[model samples]
Target: MLTKDDVRGVSAMIPTPCKEGQGGWQYEDSVDLDETARMTEQLIAAGIGSIAANGTTGECAALTLEEKLAFTRTIIEVARGRVPVFAGITTLGTKETVRQMRKFRELGVEGGFVGLPLWQTPTITNSVKFYADLAEAVPEMALMVYANPLFFKSTFPVEFWEGVGKHCPTVVTCKYVGNLMDPKNMLIDLPASMDAAPHVQFLPIDFAAPMAYDLVGDRLKGMWSTSCAMGPEPVVALQRAIDAGDKARMGEIMHDLHGLPNAIPDFKEFSKYNVQVEKIRCNAAGYIKAGPCRAPYEDLPDDWRALTVASGKAWAELCARKYR
Candidate 1:
């Protein structure tokens, strides 16, 4: 069984590799279980605190229900109690989301990471009800609320967050990826407000973990890590530095980790290729067998593909130098 404390470190967002098939794209509808299992083993070997499956980086919206559950089951199976597998439940409505969560729970998963229902942007009351319904439906399972306003299109106020946390004890963590506050000249934002609901730990998305750590330090439980998905070593190393209170080492690791993506042209603007780039990095690092993303997403421009692969290789080289 996994506890809330188990998630207080670097949890890798494991990517779902596609299989070769007779489609317009090279890899479509083919959930490559062998490669996914292999990748899970590698992440475990690299010392990731936990594995998060079917996230944005994992192309959760692109997968079928069957593929999603299969991927989650494979991760849990391969993990073999070495580390807890936190399944990602991203669906259209509260009913479907609850179904997915219950299914993963039936599969023996201890917990899940669920984003706000994306079908429509509900009001704070409805959002609170949505999560409350989910928590009530599956009272035994724990959840981490995904707070990225870019996709969810709603900024939940502190009251709303605390409402959900206090109302549902099953909701243990909240990963905020929105523009909640100034990352530059800030000491604390979410964590201080989150004290109202002491059970729920607040974390920035993995990208902002360094800034959050630099400002709030150990006040954060841990980030929901996307960077750790691609480059686990440097990201985990950064967390270790923060834990040890070594400022100099933290700066070095942050540079090495952030520098990897910045090495590419207009990397910040390359949101379209974010999933592909992470998959490319995992392949470059020998974490998974190389494969294209499922259709619609597979049609990457040649230049973008070239740049992403080059960036992944360059990042791997940096990781080898510093983390190895």
Candidate 2:
């Protein structure tokens, strides 16, 4: 089974590349496997610590089971065990989630990123049971809890983590996009959640990472980043600074990051079109071809498009200077 030690640095949540003219969610065999392989190689070469695909950023909801399986296989083949690879196995119910995870495990994925079943808001007891059941069923597969309050019903409170620590041993990490709206909640929850589930690494997203690392020291372990899709070097540089305890350097990188055009002042507004914005930035960065946002979520407001593209271009420029 995987452990907290197995996950480190920047864990990149990458986008799925859609084939030309096939960006619609319902399009059959729309995933570009060759590009997927190339993208995987690009990330590994650029020093990403680990790679996760088919999450919110990867358009997990829009991908067909066959496409997801193919995408997972492509990434695993390209990675060739160079860096740990995780594939999202989130579904609307427990049975399907387990089924998808089993398939991905067969394809040699290191772990599965799972979110809570989304049909209804699960009670805290049921939430714990959901993870426990998955662990029990797929004892060989390690799990990363996808704890995003914006997409899922559960906020993943301290109580949930306490139950997971006791009942779900295979859960080794979390893609923690915690309560960003209430910064005070994070001030309370980050420490308390870690205390409740000491064995699991709670990886805060890129924006919140510096604070999280300072709050918990080495226990912060790593971070989950969608922006790394723009390019990993800048994000990896931040990881190195954090590890070296270079607070000044950390501030420098973060300041430039916050200066990006897509770094909206209000996170709530940003969340509304995050999936689309990420795709725009990734395409603009041109680090790897991210193709287009999959259907139903593809459209972005005109102002958001302009800013997002500008952010992507700005990131590419910053990356050129190596975030000087």
lDDT of each: 0.71, 0.85
**Ten contiguous residues with the weakest lDDT in model 2:** 262-271
Q: Which residue pairs clash within candidate 1?
A: none
- Put down candidate 2 lDDT per residue, 157-267, tens digits, no spaces: 999999998999999999988777876455458888999998898888877778887788777778889888888888888888878778899899889887767545467
lDDT assessment of candidate 2: 0.85
Residue-wise lDDT of candidate 1 within 141-223, one digit each (tens)? 88877776656867766777767766777877766665634345332456555666677767666557777776666776576
Which ten residues in a row are the worst by lDDT in model 1?
20-29
Model 1 bad stretches (over 4 Å): 1-3, 21-29, 180-188, 261-271
Cα deviation of 272, candidate 1, in Å: 3.9
